[model samples]
Target: MSGSPAARASNATDHDAEQLRALGYSSNFDRSMSLWENFSLGFTYLSPVVGVYTLFGLCLAAGGPPMFWSYLLIGLGQLLVCLVFGEVVSQFPISGGVYPWARRLVGKRWAWMVGWVYAWALCATIAGVAIGAGPYLAAMLGFAPSSNANIYIALVLILLSTGLNLVGTKLLARVAMFGFLCELVGAILVGGYLLIFERHQQFSVLFDTFDININGSYLPAFLAASLAGLFQYYGFEACGDVAEETPNPGKRIPKAMRMTIYIGGAAAMFACLALILAVPDMAKVIAGEDTDPVSTILANAFGPVGSRLVMAVVMVSFISCVLSLQAAASRLLFAYARDEMIVGSSLLKRLSANQVPSIALIVSGVVPALIVCLGLFMADAVATIVGFAAIGIYVAFQLIVIGALIARAKGWRPSGQYTLGAWGLLVNIAALAYGLGAIVNMVWPRMPDAAWYINYSMILTTVVVMGAGLLYMLLAKPYDKGTAPAGDAWELSRSGSHATGRATSQGFQQAQ
Candidate 1:
């Protein structure tokens, strides 16, 4: 096989040695994360938020008792997209993840558009996740009177996570593993308690009733609710962004993604079910004074002390989610920088001694921190950010699945160990259908109320952001075509290139 276009370009460079040194191509990032670490990263990536359950309640509020079925339906829809992602990651396990795959499958211009949008979405998501960490932490510490302090706490959390990522991927993986374990134990313990003590509530209520009186159609309401539930499944792609740092990335990246989805999805499903069952009355629970469902459930199950303990667990889970998001967002920034797609390519390409993208990490963290502060001025700030982040993620997913289909149609078979086989076509179709449906639901007008107005603001904000991306593409079209060398070994390996002085070997043999 021929070498990557970037490698060929590098070979023809007048300053070849200097270019290689600057790009950190000579340094190795072949660290092996254990299966446990992989699983933990995935789990923590979907941490428990009061808002997550509250969003489900909103779904229940909007779609009635059939919300549980909506969760399952959305889960199935996401599974199809996950399969598409699984195929791509297995075939091209590079740090750029969807960006590079889109490029190869659809050409550089379209890839640039997708990468730019994904990078922005990632940054926005980091801010949204960071903002989420604050309320949970404040709730745990009984800091209700000083709700404003949550922003300060969020800043601190962002800085701490940024520091951890700067230390190295190995350390990040270790932290993720610890967080994941805590989430698992906490989920199981809480879930088991709910199952044993709270089974008196009719399970049939969670699945049967559909009495919401929204102005929208039931299908649209279900889609809206599903989008909210679907947000819980957003972080599995984090594994793909860090593919370059993993051992045997082509194989392990895909495995990690698949397991992340299955394990995390299953855990979330159980947690949601337990929360539903624990509620004394669905209508009363929806109208309850307590805004935080997990705390409320625990307070009922084991009194105030138990509620505080659950709050503490939730705080840790939020921190873990923020950390994972920070790490993943920085990787996306790094990839965009390496490809000259972002504004400051030179700064983003700088790596620390530990091979971490230090500059990118700081900038990515800081930018979102600033954006999240906007929440201080708006009542529904958190909801708006969540909605915007969700839209950004869905757009990226659409681009990736479309790219995968195009690649498959052109006979671009992946030689990796984890192939998606004949299911790829079906998966792409289902994912596209789900994605389009969710987008429509999110933008549909709701009943004239405070919540509807808030939803409208979020929808408008998302539309503006997307429009801005389109504008950026138009103005930046000329610059987007300037190709830079793919900056890491995983990318080079995918393109059939070896580092200088490395022997020419097929597949993963060179690294091994």
Candidate 2:
């Protein structure tokens, strides 16, 4: 039986190789991504999702009028983390991102554990995007009441996203760029419309505090309220996942990371401010009474047609977000599989002729499909999945920040272009604090009859998922020694004599 299992593994590897050859990708597929394309893709990853106005109501529900302060705090915290990511990504611009950095900073064993955890985190994120995409699409179609229909709609969106990714990276990048443009235009229009027509609420209202009964503790209430706000800043480091495909990744990756942070951050803050000013009664909006705060605000400012237009724009933005996330998550899975960290490692590593991680893309699509199917068992599955996914992502973010701190302590700094200066230490400390706080808020237990039992499920599932990674490390540590460092493996594949493995354009050489 052992021999049979070994034979099956060999067959799988051979099949993966055959798929890569058919896809027209050389073994050095990692070198195909250009710096500009990488930056553009990264920008899209952070841009479209800035429309958190609809969900802002939930934050208000959690924290009352003081939710704005939570947004500011979370934004500042994420900026610190982004600074850390900028420093690390600029130094080691490999595809594995945190996993590779963790390996170099700590030891290979710890690195594998980090990589496995990070990969699963990204996988959960992709599932959340898929689940979220359904409702956004359903709203656009005017199907507001049917929960089951929305699940099917979400599954269809996931499938379509998979098809686009499987087609090629160039196509994916082009679509992402277009989506970025739509997000930019939509933000400007929405903000301007609100400013011109409905600028009544004072800025001071944002900082004003109000008390609520939340299991009898104000602090817990505040934390719960801030959790929703914190979710808005979750994907800033997404660019790091695609480092392998990025040209001059060392510089471009950091630039993209920082730009996304500042641009997306500023845009979201302004949009939220505009939203607050436009609404006459923030309390009514926060009480879970308004079904569509964004559309209502726009409709009040403009008209029914105007509201539809804004919804259309928001739908486009959500689509762009889904597309960008799908690409990022698939690449992450491909990177892990290339390192043989997963069960079907060889298959997951397959690349299309266009240098896209086609097999991984298909695998990612399957995950969301399964999650959508779970909707059949419960109406709140989407919310649960998203919360669980967010927890996974936050956990990975904490690990990466911890890894970055270790690297800094060891006097390992990336030279040239985006260094964090003397403030690197300070930024790391702030990021660590922010990450830990967010994790705590996300997992803090709620009352038995709370609206979201999914939060508890998320906490439990994240623990199990992470535990699986530890188990994998214990079982696979012996074989991992034979695999070359990610940097070296990338370099060898690019320089080798294989016809498809030759490097094309180059400015900054990869670490290998």
Candidate 3:
């Protein structure tokens, strides 16, 4: 039958290569992931249940009931960012989301810097997500939430995701699909049940200002709460990261990016609303009486049995987040490596017997595992690294947005199934503004009592990431593989230390 497994596999691989050629590149990896899998990768990366669940308590503690509204604002802002990404990825459709887009649209050096920062951001995000899972695991399993336990669990979680990715894209796709069902359905059901039968407060309660701000100004308090939402919406660009392994990536990847924001954004908003409204006592929740307010809400709304059941789904969401995170990180590595843009490009691009970038996959896991190990001794490591994630990703996204704007201003137009038409400039401007605003808000320092590093952690960490990237660019000074001379290979010029090669085949002419 045409639908037989073997036949489908052959068709998929052929289609994938054909699509890659149409986008001005040749396929080097197995295209085992279906469109559903593509969508799932983004969805799980933007895993609403995991994002909202992890951030809910922190937002509540920071701004009391008013914190949830930031989700709405950030959701709308990030959607603009996603659309800009959609437009750009529609035109590029390269494996590395930011690197290829920036290289082609901006310049080679700019692309290298963006890729360096984004690569670390992705890795840090995986570690941050894993570390965030420890507390929930502790609450559900009766552990003490010790540093050692968190470190071990985070390491185990990263390894599990790494193993799944190493197997093949097909299995990863299947697991991601399963996770999509559990997290999305679990979110809807959990939210609906609480909204229908368990709400202790009215919808109006969210508008109330508890005046929890010690400085007497609500602005800072609300801004503090906004970080929670800001952190939740990134990683959707992950669809573009796996574009090489996806069939018809040009059109499908953009759609998946938007759909991830749409569905996951809705799920996060609804779930947070449910938890806020279902609080048995708002006074106690706001007064820090319920240390684990989210868990308390779930446990109170539904009995222990139901709460644990939902926690099980949350656990799945956490693993799914890590899987999607590591998978995207590996693709970013492979993409940059294949272009010979990084140190050890030859080794990093080597594929396994299964046609996967095995070294990239393992490197992706190892770096995050080390980050997790750092969390073992530093309890505050989770917040700082996640701060890096929350701020770092938005910065990476805005770099691309700025590049796209510069391209458009210089007469670049998108050629794809998705285009903004007359509103292209307008949308791009909005995206840039939103991205810049979010970054400032997240990076703006507030704590003056604590040490400099702790108070300005986000800003300081971001500077460190960028400074390190600049240093690497100066030292490594990797070559730019313009176009292949004959095939998909860039023959290094037998010349000086810095060799820029020309295309070996016909496609977009390499700028030299």
lDDT for every model?
Answer: 0.67, 0.65, 0.79
Any residue pairs clashing in model 3, and if so which? 483-503, 484-503, 484-504, 484-505, 485-503, 485-504, 485-505, 486-504
| Candidate 1 structure quality by residue, lDDT tens digits, 359-425 | 9899878987876677677646655665677777778888888776666666555445566666667
Model 3 agreement with the true structure over 8-67: per-residue lDDT tens digits? 556545655644564457766777677778889889998888888887877787788888
Among residues 3 or more apart in sequence or in different chains, the pairs in candidate 2 whose N, CA or C atoms overlap within 3 Å are 23-353, 24-353, 34-247
Relative to the unseen true structure, what is the C-alpha lDDT of residue 460 in candidate 3, on a scale of 0 to 100?
85
Best by TM-score: 3
Candidates ranked, most accurate by TM-score first: 3, 1, 2
Measure candidate 1: CA RMSD.
Answer: 6.5
Worst 10 residues of 2 by lDDT: 499-508
lDDT per residue for candidate 2 within 1-512, as digits (tens), equals: 33475564444334333323422322444344455456556666555344365466666666666666666778788888888888766655555567656654565666676666666665556666555555555555666736677677677777878888787867776777777677777887888778887886877776655556566766666777776567777565767777655544556677877777667777777777777677767667666687566666766886766666776777666666767777877877776676666677778888778778888888777876777777778656555655666777678778878877766665554443477778878889999998898888778876567655443787777777778777767876632743635322222223442221212111112211
- Name the best candidate (by lDDT): 3
| Per-model TM-score on C-alpha atoms | 0.85, 0.83, 0.90
Q: Candidate 2: where is the Cα deviation over 4 Å?
A: 1-27, 30-37, 47-51, 210-220, 380-382, 446-455, 476-482, 486-512
